[model samples]
Target: MILTGDIGKVKTLLALFSQEKEAKEVARREFYNKEYASLQEIISVFLKKNESPLKEEPIFIVCFGIAGPNINGNCQIYEPDKLDWQFTIRELRELLTANYVEVLNDMPALGYAIPKLAESDLVSFNPNVSAEKGNRAVSLATGTGLGELLLYRDRSGDFLPSPSEGGHANFAPRDNWGLEFLTHLYSQFSPPISWEKVISWSGLQSIYGYLKDRKGVKETDAVKNRLNREIPHEVILDMANQNDELCQQSLKCFASLYGAGVGDLALRTLAVNGVYIGGGMVQDILKKEITKHLFIEAFMNAFKDKEGFDKTKNFSKRNAAIPVKAFINQEMVLMGALQRARIMANLD
Candidate 1:
């Protein structure tokens, strides 16, 4: 069995696999925060719904990927205010009566699944660049919050994933506009705003709010009503697709900030092999028209700016040439957790 927790998004995904050497997913389900408050509750409901699989096959091995740091097969969720929600491998083993349970940070799971991804599972933004064999790679995801990971080649020429909390690093403003944005965020939120404050779902709302209040942009009555009724990011995206001027500007700002964040991740990790943008928001944005214009432009601009460096050295240019792609596989996190389970069972 494989379970993945996106604590930032307040959701958990569960998948059950057959016992063959080549495990196949036979059942899957998703649980949201509105329905379950704890991992134990999620497990109870999952087992009840998939009782047939349990009775027929009887799961023995389980792997879980969770948001936040994992220490000795245990993890705690800390974003959107800290919670008592915590999980441990030993406790999960007892609850599920499984022989083995392994817990890992979710970002590393995404990293582990990268090399295994099929070509069809990706949408490339940089088609001209090729991933250099055995070079390092980085993955950055922006959703409920930001998540990052690094993948390095081992002696056996296989890439191994290492988890990171780089997303929590301080936000660095790159230009006058960024400085103003940071100042605006400081006035609205507390000081020392991190990248998550500017690159997430809430970040989109923040941008819209800034434009409306500080920039004197007008919001349509329809957009205002929908914002109160639905998720702010969704409403903004929908309006932007419909060519609402204020929402369109807001989305451009959001995409530029997202691109800047990606650049920072690439530079910090020196990801020569590639950089991957994941999470559900990227998928949704790609489904619209914003991707073709602002997102890639802002990404390349921020990616290729090495302040005070000689243009002849081409440091920024070379780094900009690193392949960047959007991870389109919804099952990536599950696949990664399954791979970890296979490793624990000595099946890999």
Candidate 2:
């Protein structure tokens, strides 16, 4: 199930899934998404043609990253819910007559890709990016959801992968200002705003909407309609670029939230070796200095929550808390799945 095939280089991954009648039928009838069926069908054909039958059980990893059928490098685990229990790799391969299956979360798939990339290679799984040095590495990706991955050489000298669901955790507002903002957000929203609520794409629009309403910012009819509907990060960015003060404020708030969140994550994990910003928002905001300022301020300010770790000088170093430096601009999850497939199948 771990398909490492290039998404950018190849859009139609028919080679991974079989196009046979049985596989196609299972994909179309059993799965909600037709792309899933197509993928399985293609892979089944490839495996059957090669005649590499699985032993007792086929070991596979279903990677949910990027677009459905593109080999784009700048993809992330945009939609992982597609691989829920209903979409089993076993059933997928069964349609194709394959024998084994394994399912892995997208974050770990990126971790799986680390060893395949050269030491100096600047690679990423797009929305979820990571960097590595020797056997130690770190990955962080956020889109519809948030996840973290840590890989290091254990005492036994084996590289192991770790996963985290940091997005679902509560938000750690930085200071009185952030607290006020959080209070405002909480008062408006239901209660106990999940980190994902503030960090996810919709989260960004929610912040923008709040700012727009508070400031009475005059937006275009289209913008207002979009705001009332689904406001994308790019639309907000465009407003900021147009010198819209309200948009600027919204962006600032986003940066602060992002910084505080990442800082808390670093402290919790001690990701000193390197930290990566892998999420649609991070990629968009990284291009501007204001975004960096807010994120840096809020993230470093988290140290104030504790002693020893809150030292001011720690924020000055660029390497310790690099942003987007090790972005996985590639379909890292897919690549990781491919590398893992190679390793597990002893193809390496």
Candidate 3:
């Protein structure tokens, strides 16, 4: 069994897999944690619900890919984003009675899925460029928060992934608008603006706030109501799709900020293999037609990865040469956990 999802959402996703003769899913379920007293409760219900047909195959492992960093089998989550209670690996082992239990940071979990990603699973930002093998990086922006990490191949050619606290690193502004946004955030939240402040869910909302409150951009009352009641970024994207100027500008700002951050990751990690953009929010971003162009162009312009003294031509060439893609499949983390579980159980 494997579980993966944002902890802040109080959601549980479980997948049962068999790797004996073939690697495949035997069963799967997704449920809100709020519906049950604990994960143990829903997992018991899930097992009973799917018991009969697959009773012949018994589960031997359970792995979790957590949104926060994991150290010594315990998740070091942000205090404010605590789960109802942290589930210990030992407790999970007892509940499932599995032979092995594993925990992984979400960013690394996302990285582990890169090798298995098919072209169909991606929407390329810089198409027609082949990625050269080296290190790779993943930058994820979810409703929960922002995460970044690195993946490098071992001697055996399997990826060895690591967690990162890079999202909390200071935000680097790109232009006047970026500086203005930084000042706006500083005025509100005070000092040390991080990339998480400009590129994640709250980041998206921050952009909208900058436009509506500071730039004096207009927003309809309906949009305002929707923003309060519905998911903020989703509402913004929907409004942008409907040609709302304020919403459109917010999306554009988000794309550019995201580009700058991804550019930083690619440069810092020297991720010649490629840079992957993933998270729960990707679907919303891709729904608007212009978002891809906005993101791609911004990423290229921000791709100050490397340049020779020749400057202009070299800068353009360097920017255009890097490979970037946004993955829309929401199952990568779960699949990654499954992959890790398989590795733990010696199935691969």
On TM-score, the candidate that comes out on top is 3
Give the per-residue lDDT of model 2 (tens digit) for 245-338.
6666777677667655665655566554445555455656555655545444544444223434346634434223332334535456655655
TM-score of every model versus the real structure: 0.86, 0.65, 0.88
Please provide, for model 1 over 176-294, each residue's C-alpha lDDT reduced to its tens digit, 9 standing for 90 to 100: 88888889999988877888777788888888998999899998999999988898888888888888989888878877777777776777777888888878887887786654455
Query: Which is the winner by lDDT between candidate 1 and candidate 2?
Result: 1
List per-prediction Cα lDDT, in the order shown. Answer: 0.76, 0.52, 0.75
Q: Compute the lDDT for candidate 3.
A: 0.75
RMSD from true fold, candidate 3: 3.0
In model 3, pairs of residues that clash are none
* lDDT of predicted model 1: 0.76
Q: Which runs in model 3 stand beyond 4 Å of their true positions? A: 1-8, 53-55, 75-83, 216-230, 304-308, 311-316
The Cα error of candidate 1 at residue 333, in Å, is 1.7
